[model samples]
Target: MANISQLSEEERNDIVQRLKRIEGQARGVQKMVDEDRECGDILTQLASIRAAVNSLNGELLEAYLLRCIQNPDDFGSPEKAVQQAVRALVRS
Candidate 1:
């Protein structure tokens, strides 16, 4: 399996912290399963984790767009970078 790497230190830390929190949530889910906790409770936790992940992805994409693709003052450069980013993101 290929190991995906983070591109920036700040982003890496943010993601790592989020993952650690998710790990804790997973552990909690396991305990909930072991103890036969309510299905609704488990589903709620799962949904929270999914939402957190999606929010992180959105944050990273917005940051990339604003910092990398939107900063160029020259005409067409920013748009080109945006298109490239969109293609790369779609491919991934």
Candidate 2:
């Protein structure tokens, strides 16, 4: 399928920035493991990373729904586009 959603440059940059921060967190977690840090501390950092990822997922979902609303023709009708958006959310 063709790309159905197109986000602005700022939105795309925000996502890239978030991914970079997550990457750094992952490396820090690895370092903590290598240094034999407290288990609780490592788990805390892992939880943070997971939460950040979930936040990004939410932003993408919102973007998809908005795109579906904007380009209902792509899905045949507005109602169908809504259905598609609902399905996307459910799958997510």
Candidate 3:
């Protein structure tokens, strides 16, 4: 597996917080299931979690592109780097 660069402290914290919130939401969903909560409400929360995760993924990808692929003044192989990034992003 390719090693990813470390995130900034702020970015790291933000990701942790988002993950925590998602975790909590999942737990709540479990509780809802146990208590037989409204299906619509549970589904709504699940959808929200999915959207949040997708948004977080987009943010991380954007940061990676900016820092790894675009900001390098001496990429040595700029075309290859950009193509790789584009391909990865498209696959994502």
Give the winner by TM-score.
2
User: What tens-digit string does per-residue lDDT give for candidate 3 at 44-78?
Assistant: 98998899889888987877677556544434466
Global Cα lDDT for candidate 3: 0.76
What lDDT score belongs to each candidate, Candidate 1 first? 0.70, 0.88, 0.76
The TM-scores, one per candidate, come to 0.64, 0.85, 0.77
TM-score of 3: 0.77
RMSD of each: 5.4, 2.1, 2.9
By summed lDDT, the worst window of 10 consecutive residues in model 1 runs over: 1-10
Candidate 1: clashing pairs of residues:
none
Best by lDDT: 2
Q: Per-residue lDDT tens digits of candidate 2, residues 1-92?
A: 11523677888889999999999999999999999999999999999999999999898888888788888987888889989998989988
Q: How should the candidates be ordered by lDDT, best one leading?
A: 2, 3, 1
Report the C-alpha displacement of residue 17, candidate 2, in angstroms.
0.5
lDDT of 1 by residue, 8-78 (tens): 77778887898898889888889999999999999999998888777777776666555545454432576
Q: Which scores better on lDDT, 1 or 3?
A: 3
In model 3, which regions exceed 4 Å deviation?
1-5, 71-76
